[model samples]
Target: MRCGTRWARSNHFRSLPQRPDSMSIVLTPQELRSHLERFPRVSLGYYPTPLDHWTQLEKHLNRKGRFYAKREDLSGLAFGGNKVRQLEFLLGDALAVGADVIVHGAAVQSNYCRTLAAASRKLGLDCHLVLSRAYDQPEDQGNFLLDRIAGVSIELIDEPLGAEQEARKRRATERLAAAGRRPYLITYPQSEILGTASFVGAAVEIFDQFQGLPSVPRYVATAAVGATQAGLLLGLRLLGWKGHVLGFSPLNGGEYAIQEAIWSGIRAVAQLLDIEPSLEPNDVHNLADYAGDGYAKVSTAAVDAIKLLAQTEGVFLDPVYTGKAMAGLLDYFQKQKIPPEEDVIFVHTGGNTALFAYHREVLSLL
Candidate 1:
């Protein structure tokens, strides 16, 4: 729940982790792209997902500033999400290490594990999930159903995201090793940098996409905890972007805990890039105000957001992730934390399937 403890040294890096160079060098978007591309990766999702204008949302909300959605939901993988970008680098390392299977542990309906399963199947690799049966998704729906369809092995556990769930993943890894299968446990912090590092590349994508917009966004808001937020922070900082990243969390970790994980992730990604971590942990706008009830639980605002976005923009936001984040963005607009006249971008990390899993909750509001 608290995003696992701070990242210990990750052992799965594509290259040896190095300290950030003491020198500060401002890298252009093009230069940063070069630096990021040096790492090993396998293409999975469609890159540079469209930064489409929320053409109708402005008038729908009667807002002054323009709004846009960075369409990560269209990331063209198994029901796209922000995780697909991370997995390209993650699975790349998995294959490089001669691994035949990926062992991942997460919430029962995690978008990360679901996308990972689909990516593994696409690559002809096996995937074994150690899912925490902590949430109330009793029926096989949303990500769980998709995982079932993918035909990956599942070891369901009664525990939440504490030690036992993680231990199950370790035990599964041992079993696989004994069975002569090369396994890559994604929970292992070692190779996580590979995934987060790819996000720096995402920042570059954002920078390039903004060129056609009215102005660079004042805030880039999304549902993120650790690696995704870290990548955006590091990559944006590296590109000398001035905008803030509003990381709206759906999980109920104290703000400090989530912020610390994000900070640790930022440092790790910077080390991998061999660049100075110029940003501080406090630099992250890790807001929990919009995290409804907690991870996977429904919230009134999120449902309203889902309904509003679907009706106004013909887009759907999942209960677990994007919906809550959309709520946060709207709240910011309402509270004037983000001036209504200032342009903003919402990164839609997809999981609309989760809507079906919350039929009772969503339909009650609808």
Candidate 2:
């Protein structure tokens, strides 16, 4: 949140204000692509998702600058979400090590679970999911249903998402290995770090898409858990762009934990790309206030955001991730944290399938 004298608010780039010398350096899209090619990748989703200029939403808000949503939501996969991007590199790592089975875990209606299952099937690999019972409803709808359709092995645990649940996933991976199956645990940090490369590639793609002024967003925001956000920041850094990367934490609390995750992601990703990390902890902003009551619990504001986008732009955002992020974007706009004069982008890290699971809550808001 400490982006000082941004070009967005200052005369619309007709005259730009002074920034640190680090901001002066810029890299070409091809340079970033070369660095990204060093890592192996699986083509599970479409590359360079569209940068949509939501003029209808902009008209509704009556903002002067350009308003865009980088549609990672429309990633061409089983259901399409940002997880498709991460899984490309993550699954590639699995194949590189000859992994025949992929083991992962998260909440019951996780976008990651659905995407991974679909990708695993695509690559002819077995998939197993150790899911936490984080929801109060039947798991017969939304992403869980999709998982069932994928025919992946499923273990629904009574625990919530935390270290204990992570341990459960590791144990499951070990059990798979004992059965003489080659397994890759995507829950591990090493595998998770590879996901960063996908988003870093995303930043490079978005940067190239933004070739003109006013169309270029000064603020790039997303629902992040550090690694994804860090990769985007690294992409911007390598390109010598100091655009504000606003991260809305889907998890409601734990400020320190969020900061640690993001900083570690920055460090880990830089190491992966063989560059000294140029991003500091302070540079990262994990805004968790918009996370309603807790993780997976949709807030009133988030529902409003979901409704607004759907009604105006015909874009549907899932209750858990992108909806809350859109809420934060509006909150920032209201508070002038992201002023009206500067362009802004909300990175739609998709999860609309969860809408069916949270139908009652979403309907109440309407």
Candidate 3:
């Protein structure tokens, strides 16, 4: 019935040894009361999603590390994905500040955009999206299809004019204000980190889940982005998760660029939680070696990894984010960089629907 602890009742973990040392890291109701006040958020997900062993996948990895998955993808809103967790807090903040509408910018296939649309609908707020030409959807599939189905208003910004997109969204907000709509921009530098808080809450959930387990993970790998990775790292520090929070960037940016985003998100966490300013930039770990050809463009290994997982585990991972991250994880396992018997949890950030677009490439791999 509790957040992270709810998984304790699942049949998956029932057969495993009940190590007396195994413990859960969720916050007490009292602690949550204090922790939540520092951050503003919306209620958009079912927190403490199940943590289950990927025994099938783990065994295949053939590494010493134990493999586990924190199913944030099952967060229980808008067809489930990790973004729902962040939206719960991010949108909650927007509403608390009297925002009647929310706007964001991302690629057309952005899970964030789709999930935000769903969050806006649930909270009775209008939603607007600005995306680059590459994200433009002529037919609608994956997140794009879902966005249309959700009835989210759209503005397609051709080319790479980042400033123009921001200005347009801002102008849209102004127009809404003129129309007596208390629109919330949910723009970057503010809403970005607010969305990250949910992930920090997630980190706390992870800490609780691992507390009872006798063995500890040496590394926890997950896809990186502006928010998900940030929240995970912050939560690790907050709860003192004694493991390497490995962020495998799906995009092509290098360590410093990725670290900058993570640092900003970390600052947001510190400010929201009144946490000590003790975190250092060096504390963050980026797995840059795995980003093959850069963001969104499928790499050879990424294609292979997707096929391997589908055939072996029957778990479909999206080509853009989760699939690529899993590619890195599998690579590490094969290379023997991750030691055997060490506990490792991969955060499955959900985007399987996106795979259909790359059907030809994916089909070739199988």
Per-prediction count of colliding residue pairs? Answer: 4, 0, 21
> By the lDDT metric, which is better: model 2 or model 3?
2
* TM per candidate: 0.93, 0.90, 0.86
RMSD of each: 3.3, 9.4, 9.5
Candidate 1: residue pairs that collide: 10-190, 11-190, 12-190, 12-191
Please give, for residues 243-330, the per-residue lDDT of candidate 2 as tens digits.
Answer: 7899998886762387777777677666545565456779888888998887888789999999999999999998889899899889
The 10 consecutive residues of candidate 3 with the worst lDDT sum are: 1-10
**Stronger candidate by lDDT (1 vs 3):** 1
Lowest lDDT 10-residue stretch of candidate 1: 1-10
Alpha-carbon runs more than 4 Å astray in model 1: 1-21
- Tell me the tens digit of each residue's lDDT in model 3 across 72-149: 778888878888887776676666566777777777777788888988999898887887665434345677788889
Candidate 1 per-residue lDDT over residues 1-366, each given as its tens digit: 111232323444445645445545678998788677656678899989999899898898787888988888899999888889999987876776678898888878788889999999999999999988877775477788999999999988889886798788878888888888888777746445665687787888998898898777878888887777778888888878877999999977662377877777778767666788568767987888888678778999999999999999899998878889998888888889888788888889888878878888889987
lDDT values for all models: 0.81, 0.80, 0.71
Which ranges in model 3 have alpha carbons more than 4 Å from their true place? 1-33, 135-138, 254-256
